[model samples]
Target chain A: FFQISPAPSYANPGIMQETISVNDVKDAHKNWCNALLAISKAHSEGGLAKSKPLASEIIDAAYAYQFGPVAFKPTWAYGKKTFRTTKDGALSYFIGDNPKFNDPGFGIGSPGNKDYPNLKNRSPWVKCTPENFAIQIFGNTAIGMGWVHFEAADGYKSKVDKTLSYIRDDEGNLRITVHHSSTPYSW
Target chain B: FFQISPAPSYANPGIMQETISVNDVKDAHKNWCNALLAISKAHSEGGLAKSKPLASEIIDAAYAYQFGPVAFKPTWAYGKKTFRTTKDGALSYFIGDNPKFNDPGFGIGSPGNKDYPNLKNRSPWVKCTPENFAIQIFGNTAIGMGWVHFEAADGYKSKVDKTLSYIRDDEGNLRITVHHSSTPYSW
Candidate 1:
């Protein structure tokens, strides 16, 4: 027996239905990449104080956290921290410095220095590019999957497989409901 | 620089626009649950010979592997097997017994015996229930996130947090493009 009752229809008859186009999805990806770059730049210039607020704003603008908990499986998060459903968890994943999660701050990165000699040398990301292999649009919602290549200021390049599910909000803004990223499997 | 060129729209102007209701998403979930139960039953009644074909059919009918690589992250998979994009990988995840992937066969559990002395005792699942916490329907596409509970014949109960992103196919069938499952974080 199903324990969940079907939710009420989110559609409003009074509002005109606007179909989401492929360009819209691309634009959304661009916005996301730009936000990540901005956060990294902020962190490099003024540390967490500058980056944390920007990361928060980006999360608020990009994700569907307002509706409820988002399904966020970050690239490096593992074990108990694999899924980040809460806004605070999302923030910590982006900018880190949160003692509770012990995250390396994927966006900000950590430098290899005396304090953390074992940690990998990762500088703030300076370049971000999305290479979508498949994009399926279903009216107001869309799903895109492909590889996202990231480059840190130290010239280190990393790539991860990424999938993002988007739903158009009442104001025609596309918000991410599911974001899953993982490194490619190697034999 | 974005490396992806925007894909052409999939909408057909001649066809009448059909909005996907919340019930449709629930129905899709029900179909998925039923398929899992059927696979388990098949394995119990006739072993891998009987269950393998059924698993293959279910994978084809349910997943969007036709569109391209699906972003699938199974619950128990780890290391190089974490993400299953290829159809072969998906099949291996469901039925196991494939030496290439070295899967424990999540759907068809291993019994406590000499061959698998260290393996946990797990019987074929007999019941499946989905409790969706959030379902966001955007016309032809939908995303659902919740917990799915499964019960094996031995009365062992397992629950996993799941997220599924579905897009309505040309034939009016809901096909999953992104399926992510993980155990709830225990901190």
Candidate 2:
């Protein structure tokens, strides 16, 4: 279900043999995509009494300072290196090619990879407010979506959809796992 | 707000000099103890958020692997060493500590360092899972926690919580900044 680098000399290993398929696309996408979904589910599925802890947990994990530098993007530096981010601006990165300049959403592929990066040239940086997220969890699986109305440093603003997935470990216990995301576009 | 191992010397460079206050403890212990109520609001405020994409990005950043070795534990007679992930029959390390381990909750504290014995015995091991986490963020301060429940090497099972903290960067953004963890404990 995972890969390493494009290095020519890197050897192939079959440790994580579970491949992503229609059967597993849901599970394989667990940890990454599901966590996003779980948060939403935790809110909507439970009562205020129940959801409070869930909400607090979500807030604590997402906004905690412990995430430190590795969890952040130095947009200015990222722009210098990958031309994907801006300095004190909006988040920008597309999964496609030549997206419309005026388009509100971002792309998620080199024209086509997976999911719905329906636009181009913009970033899929979702402005996730605590209010916009929708979350759900299944046996050994979880999913979520948080909408962010953020404008990139370049001033590209849109209601971004942040998709998420989750999976359980070998013990058959599900956790926030996969996170698959694509910004919505109005082409 | 803090630095990592190998604490720096040279007086910390005194970025700013200011006076602080402290109080004595007066609580239910039948003695006088000091309670904290916002002694100094100057350091920085904690951060807050409902959901984050740090883990998602980490997963997306993870390279897919088709083939690789297990790099098994030590052994000379075994010849050609290969990688090995104890995915099979793996139980939680907290089993011995909490026999009633029925819940999917993570026990906080580092493994060793005299805090928790369950974790002390298992050095260099960290729990990994897919679950919701949260953090506190302020003007220039933050802290967080992430958890995922799973089975360990035997019949043991438990949840893993990876807690972290950090200070804001010059640009007023929080990065992974700093990471500290808890011992993998049972329910």
Candidate 3:
């Protein structure tokens, strides 16, 4: 006989709605970092052959998490005019045709090829070190804020603060509804 | 006799959860502008006695909308290291010791006294013109993005982009959860 799932308890309504655990949050962040590293390595190594898969994985995750969809426009604050609302726009910022602020000579696209359709060139993000991670969880909703130090392939490094807001789907998968990032101000 | 609210529809769970009408959103924005105008007028007219009540009204609305008792921190980004999380902090940004960027000669707090405890400065914001307002509502949560142009008492003008995220409380009152604002980048 097929096993029947336990009925949802009415005693605590919070229990019924809450599904994501601390582990889930941790895992998501870990996976994200891993993906970034992998993409960097792939771009430096085999170029498009290796990196495309990782980029595809990120796009898949974006869809699964409902980012850049109609409900969630994933506002990205790279610059005044470069506020990206779509997934493609975000991809463009990270590993697309956009020129890097620090080094305008070196663009932000794939490692070796700037014209590569799906994230060419190795815009190497060597490390993703996060500091002061503050996570707040409410009923089926959560927000994570942290300062991240990113080491680039060209020995360039910068610190940026990030705020990510989430909402759990009906099937209990936590999806990001808002993602905002900005470089720390310096006089 | 007591009237029970209708059961949530199984056909479309999203529709079932969405309770706010388009009118409610419009009214909220209108009231917000009105309150801002009132506060500016009160500050200019009578200082502490006049402006304190308007500030308290905003605070009460914040509480009613579930902003910053615990779950909501209401992170407001005015500038670098100028993130105001508390109600008092936000007020400080508007009409407190923080000097306005465009008009450095004139401060934001009480006109005659910078020591005015509760928003003493007659920092008259002559106009609050919002452009490109994009408001997205889902269920009990919403986000509004726009560009706001502020004209100071001395005809000094500055434009800042703003993002406001909101959530409806258990009592069906809309409250701001996140408010981020930054001046346009200048090369």
Winner by TM-score: 3
Candidate structures ordered by lDDT, highest first: 1, 3, 2
DockQ of each: 0.10, 0.05, 0.13
DockQ for candidate 2, please give it.
0.05
User: Which residue runs does candidate 3 get wrong by more than 4 Å?
Assistant: A1-17, A21-33, A46-53, A63-81, A98-123, A131-138, A153-155, A185-187, B1-18, B21-33, B63-82, B97-123, B131-134, B185-187
* Candidate 2 lDDT by residue in tens digits, A1-187: 1232232222644342223333343433332223334433443355334434543454333321221111222111232322111111112221112233222212221222223334334333222232225566453335555654443334444444555444333222232323333456668
lDDT of 3 at A15: 33
Over B1-187, each residue of candidate 3 has an lDDT whose tens digit, in order, gives: 1223566568734333446555556556555556666777777787756676666677568533234422222223323334445555555544454453211112232233333232233357666666534555556766555566667576656565555566677667767666555444333
Q: Flag the better candidate by TM-score, 1 or 2.
A: 1
lDDT of 1: 0.76
Q: Which wins on DockQ, candidate 2 or candidate 3?
A: 3
Against the correct fold, how does model 1 do in TM-score?
0.65
The ten-residue window of minimal lDDT in model 1 chain B covers: B110-119
Q: After superposition, how far is residue A147 of candidate 3 from its true place, in Å?
A: 2.9
What tens-digit string does per-residue lDDT give for candidate 2 at B1-187?
2222231223532121111111100011001000000101110122111011221222112211122222222111112212212211001111112233221112221223343322333221123344435645443434555653433233244444544343233222233323233346659
Clashes of each: 0, 106, 9
Q: Which candidate number has the best DockQ? A: 3
Better of 2 and 3 by lDDT: 3
TM-scores vs. true structure, each candidate: 0.65, 0.20, 0.66
lDDT score for residue B104 of model 2 = 14
lDDT tens digits by residue: candidate 1, A5-95: 3554667233444677888888888778899999999998999899999999999989989977787877767666667878888999998
